[model samples]
Target: MALRIPKAELPLEVRENMVQQLGAVPENVEVTWHSPKVAQDDMEFGGEVGAWDAADASLKSFAQMAVPALVG
Candidate 1:
């Protein structure tokens, strides 16, 4: 599973702190920093949904995309 956190809202120092507190970072986890313009473009192209909703939609889309790869 992937986790997306808005870097602008939570700075890198905070994220590093959390990682340090956690003691271990999973291999499956990814941290991405989205620029304001790129983020806006993503929302506009996808749907105008709230964060959680957009995340759900993205996950669903990823799962669907993965089906063929998994089968082949």
Candidate 2:
């Protein structure tokens, strides 16, 4: 049997904070953990943008994901 390791290790402070807020460290977040400052700012910016309620969430989710999938 083989064991898998994380791509990047997160700082304990950041990891615990993520766990508290999000239940677990999400895979997408692992990329930003390399720069803890970016990770923190991303979280803050995400909090700000994520609170908007003017759009239908399902369409917002679809557009958010779909365009990335269609990029050149």
Candidate 3:
């Protein structure tokens, strides 16, 4: 039988912030947030890592999306 995963619920404020920034809560954010402390730290770290502006935005987005698929 296939396993069923439960839906993630973010705090109302966090949900609103994520939606405002991304247009929706990304599945990656939900999955990465399985633990509150880890999720908080991960999101903060992701913000820091995502702030480098030298690279072209389009290229960086493509690379970020591609690397995970390639690795997996």
Candidate 4:
């Protein structure tokens, strides 16, 4: 879903490792990063990064939420 990672909190290497384990590139999946300033928005918080089934109902739910959040 909408995943907000503070770049300062996660080093590039860690993110790269996660991407490899997830078996997807950043372009292949939905993701977003926010600076501490923009991160203050109420609508942009608690985004999580993890593996999700492409066909799972829960994944769909998060996708729905993530797409719009990232788009707007």
Candidate 5:
């Protein structure tokens, strides 16, 4: 069981916040983000998310992130 994500894809604080919001997500389960990249209009954006616990496991995710748009 392990959590793997591309480096810098997510920050520790953001990950912690997700854990807090999504509760405990089992390891090994593959989660797919429908809208990985979202537009920030007025500094806000949202979309549906999905996670597969197993072949017989499915969930409807209403995850939304409201953060200041990062400027590179």
Candidate 6:
């Protein structure tokens, strides 16, 4: 059987998209916080800060959804 994933563990954009498309996540779904630090770290050494900026943008979009904790 397939295990359901948590909405919070998903990328903010992905969670937003899911909310837009599926209305809601099922009750059995697990959840976790999405840390922006992780996003920044992944992009910090990419020769420039563009990746980090993009990650921030994603977090901003998530903030609009009232899920600011998604950023950490």
Worst 10 residues of 3 by lDDT: 1-10
* Residue-level lDDT tens digits of model 5 in 1-72: 444642234446545766797684323121332223321221132222233234422322312222323321
Candidate 1 clashes between residue pairs 3 or more apart in a chain or in different chains: none
Task: Please give the CA lDDT of all the candidate structures.
Answer: 0.52, 0.79, 0.81, 0.49, 0.36, 0.52
lDDT of 3 by residue, 6-27 (tens): 5578889999999999999987
* lDDT measured at residue 57 in model 1 versus the true structure, 0 to 100: 64
> Could you say which candidate leads in TM-score?
3
Order the numbered candidates by lDDT, best leading. 3, 2, 6, 1, 4, 5
Top-lDDT candidate index: 3
Note the clash tally of each candidate: 0, 0, 0, 0, 0, 1
Candidate 5's C-alpha runs over 4 A off are: 1-8, 24-44, 47-72
Residue lDDT tens for model 4, 1-72: 553543344356646865787664343122233343443342134233223325767888898999999999
lDDT of 6 by residue, 1-72 (tens): 554653346566756865786696433332323454654454345437544444556777666877656655
- 66 Cα displacement, candidate 5 (Å): 38
> Model 2 misses residue 5 by how many Å?
13
- Compute each candidate's TM-score over C-alphas: 0.25, 0.56, 0.58, 0.25, 0.26, 0.26
Cand. 4 TM to true fold: 0.25
Q: Model 2, residue 42: what's the lDDT?
A: 88
Query: On a 0 to 1 TM-score scale, where does candidate 6 land against the true structure?
Result: 0.26
After superposition, which runs of candidate 6 have C-alpha atoms over 4 Å from their true positions?
1-8, 27-72
Question: Which segments of candidate 4 are over 4 A away from where they belong?
Answer: 1-54
